[model samples]
Target: MTGQGSEGTFCLVLHSHLPWLAHHGAWPVGEEWLYQAWAHSYLPVVDLLRRFADEGREDVLTLGVTPVLAAQLDDPYCLRGLHDWLGNWQLRAHGAARGLPDLAAREHRASRWALEEFETRWRHGFSPLLRSLVDSRVVELLGGPAAHPFQPLLDERLRAFALRTGLDDTQRRIGTRPEGIWAPECAYAPGMEAGYAAAGVRRFVVDGPSLRGQTWAGRTVGDSDVVCFGRDLEVSYRVWSPKVGYPGDPAYRDFHTYDHPSGLKPSRVTGVHVDPRDKKPYDPDLAAAAVRRHAEDFVDVVVARLRSLRERHGRALVVAAYDTELYGHWWHEGPAWLEAVLRALPEAGVRVTTLRGAVEAGHVAGPVEIPPSSWGAGKDWHTWHGPQVSDIVHGNAEVQRELLELDLSGPVRDPVADQAVREALLSLSSDWAFMVTKDSAADYARYRAKVHADRFAELAALCRTGRGSTGRGHERAAELRRVDGPFGHLDARSL
Candidate 1:
């Protein structure tokens, strides 16, 4: 155990991710999903971190930017689409000025601010913006497998390939390789730590129950020196949870119940059972108060939790992990609350650090064998493999089996074969299965999975027949590339 001061260490791990949504549909569930999250969550959070960096604060938190999400953010198609989306947001705010003047005014200001930030900081790509943060030492970035595959179900060879490729892509974009990863969904299986260590990943996260609720310090995986930090759900749930959390406050802007006139959320969460039509107009002042109260309450929770954990363990560490999109995107006042908490933790004598910082400071325990688990429902793998999503599971399994059998070596190697692997990996993303299980956007998820599967099958067939470079094969490859071309330098030989 490591010695600590009066206050214990607190690490905030935010997983920022989204499925590949570039050339897909736009309105209710497609590219719009990417744009909204970009405008609401990424921009504000980055701004907050930059402010802290300027104030000479290092290791504000640990941020996990999945390779697939990074690819979309750095894609030209998505960048142009996001730019137009911001413009439309401003127009919508202007259109609502008459009916909901107060809401419209606030939205207009927000839209303009988002537009300016996107144009200035994110114009080229997220690479420069994220690289700046890493270079400034404000946050330790976590990289994950390409396409965010649930590694437990993946073939061992393909898993290693995905991890290496994803890490290489991260290094290419961000100018540095990540030493830690936010395992997709915090899912883990025995012996996966050896693969992480081989890829130079020194640390990753798992759910609290994976450690049997003892998460005071990072645990070594199996006999490997790699560290696994468990999420402190007690502290994390205070900010956001299933039934009751700060986001459910009556004063906060309601995420659902959108106003049809201007496509803006103009109402507050009146009550648990309040009708959309009966909800009152959103009051910024009231929401601001809620953010303040929630932020202070969260700080107290962390301080108290750390102090309590210290009683049992001499030196303690508390890790609170959450989806970065929760702030500003789902819960409108989340970014403000996050900023408040980040600032208040230090003032209250809590040591705010990153997972890497804690590990380097020797705040880690001995090896422990972790069972198969994820931070999903029931703290198990059922969400991705349950009866509800059996089809997706079987389909992904077939794709992976076919992918491992493909021959991409020697003189017969085809470029189309490389694209086939890419498509297969995209199809294997856990998002499709997760969406189907959650019923959030089942149809879209199914459609995306089918599209990628069809593309992979078609390309693989062409390669198998030695016609991958022929006329029809070339045309099909071109079409697929035009639609999904994030990893341009992908080489099948790597696999």
Candidate 2:
């Protein structure tokens, strides 16, 4: 163990991810999901990071970009779609100008900024922007399974393949392989750290409950060299509590209430219990004041939490992890709050850094055994494995069983065989199960899972019968390639 420093560390881990949404439906939960996040969350957040970088901030946070989301961000089709979406945003704002001029002006300002940023920096792809951040040490990047599969439920061989392929894909895209990962759903099972170790992962994140409330420092899982950092729920929940949090403050913009004509949020939260129709028009000045207030409050919370933890644990670390989309996507003023919080933390005397930086700064507390867990409800695996999603669970197993059977017979050789593997991997995405269980677009989730599973079955049948090379299979494979390809680095023969 290394010497503990006086200042406790704080890690801000922002998980940036969305399931593959390319060529999916447009509204409610498809391409629209991707575009809204890109415009409101991703754009503003990255802009904040670039600003911080320009000011010479290093290791400001850790960013986890799942391979599937990374692929979509860099896809040509997605790029074109985002551009069109931004253009439409501007058009909608223009149309709203007469009736709701004040709201329309705000919409215009926001949409115009989005359009300008997209044209100047993002027209080509996401890799360059994210790669720049990684190269410059603005943030530590994390790689997860290619499709963000729930690693604990996956077959050992398939999980390993997905992980390695994911790491390699990130390396190929951004020129630096990640040593840390935001485990899918922050899910874990006994001995899973070894799988991470085998893939050269040095660290991973899980919910604090998995650490049994011992979250003041990183703990090595059962003496493995790899470390597990649990999110400090005390600190994290201060900003994200489902019951009450900073984002729900009356002064912030209401995420749920929208000026439908302009596709813009036009009202302050006003009150959590206030009707959306009765909410007050958003006041930028008031929201800006709230951002400052919350930033200072959060700094106090972090300092107090760290001090209290260090009193017991000695030179502890406080990790506050949140979904990256919560910023600007779910909360209209979130990016600003994030910026204010990040800038204020250090000034309040906390040692703010990335997860990797925390490790290097000797923020570890020796080894411990983590239990089977996830960040979901009950801090267990139920979110992805609940009775509600039992069909999905069973369905995934059937597909994996079929995949293993194919592999056992012989090395699969056709490109269509690889597509079968690809579709199977897609079918196993944790998003579908999570969505279904959460009742957020359950029908779409089921439809997506079934489509991928069906396609996998058809392709696998062709491969098993040795009909995959040249013919209808090839044409079908081409369609798959054009329609849903994300991981160019994956090959079934290799997996």
Candidate 3:
């Protein structure tokens, strides 16, 4: 929608999340996902922001971290595991020296930097680094549901609990509470704004179609003061679209063409349909040049979009949001391009600000109703609730129902009940259904969903027995707690 005012602002939002993977499986999925995203995406992205902050940039972007993922980043087990993984990565790079010398050199250098960064700065855990960023106003952090659950498909009571708990978890870690959220999956249903307002969230994001493609400015939801910022897909997809995106450029590293010996990617994209073995060796100089060109092109696009929108509205705020992992994790050159774009935007006269800054600057286009929607395929709920995930959809519903019915009220809070809540939340994570529907690590996604579901049932049944946690039940709860722990401050009674 055309928002109010003549001044134009551009807001870049990145949703950073992974399901609770602390004690879950490793390799292929689980903890591996966490470490990869952390090293390749979070580490570099945050570093770039910190560097720019040194040069005095404020409100660089809005980054959202789901509470489940936040807990993993701070967990002792995860911290220790990441240290080991970096060491292992160094070994893997060394092992590649004989097989692919050039790639080995690059990998070794990167691995060394990663390990050093982890040891010196990240060893303390995520909160300190994130807290500093928040304190300095380097970036705006957006909080979300505790488990990154699909909010539109969630029970209202659970939804509110998750949001409040998630925001509280963020406050505990970063010191300042988030006023906005990168709504889980950018998913929403009618009246959800009321729940957000109830949880003290002043703003959230949704897909463009949710606002009927009027994405030029923020719009208030229903009668609530909570504002909804629709992602401008036209701007976001220039760098993220699967087919035509800048990441697919031939000069960039090919994500799929890996040198199996060392588990490192060494080839340039060459062509979308080219055989992996036929791709050319990746050249950093070439990729850097492409980054510069694409970054300039992006700036030009934003300028043109803002110029077009300015003709209709007094103020234009062009929003472009993407998953945080997309940068270094999936697209090797993404972080460089991002830095380039952020640096160029201001020089091009575009106000680079966060979604909050947009609201504060009066970007509201007035109240509008949002329907059931998501950033998922077709801009609807099918990814989490579609026919392909019918089993998972049904399983999650049953888990939520049982948890709601269970009596967790007691004078002394029971770890059993607390874990049951955690398990239930983990089981309901949208990642499982999404993976299953998309066929990306479907087995791992299913296994995790079932594991959490089973844990929830076991814990819930023990709580229902009305016997104080003891013997086998006590031992079982402890075991599960050790593995699935996240959101330590969560109160099951919040249900």
lDDT of each: 0.90, 0.90, 0.88
Candidate 2 local accuracy as lDDT?
Answer: 0.90
Angstrom error of the Cα, residue 168, model 3: value is: 1.5
Top TM-score prediction, candidate number: 1
lDDT of 1 by residue, 409-491 (tens): 86644668878988998898999999999998999999999899989998998988889879888788878888887666677
The 10-residue segment of model 2 with minimum total lDDT is 1-10
The list of candidate 2 runs beyond 4 A from truth reads 1-6, 408-413
Better of 1 and 2 by lDDT: 1
lDDT of 3 by residue, 1-495 (tens): 133222379999998988887777787887898998998998899889889788887899998888888898899999999999889988998998887888889989999999988888898898999888888887899998888999888889888888888999999888888999989889998999999998889999998889998998899999999999999989989888755899999999998888876788889999999999899999999999999999989988998899888887756789999999999999999999999998878777888888878888888887899989999999999999999999999999999899889887777778778888989988999999999999999998999899999989988888888543877777787788888888888888767
In candidate 3 the C-alpha lDDT for residue 81 amounts to 94
Per-model TM-score, in order, reads: 0.98, 0.97, 0.97
The number of the candidate with the highest lDDT is 1
Tally clashes: model 1.
0
Error of 1 at 248 (Å): 0.5
Show model 1 residue runs off by greater than 4 Å. 1-5, 411-413
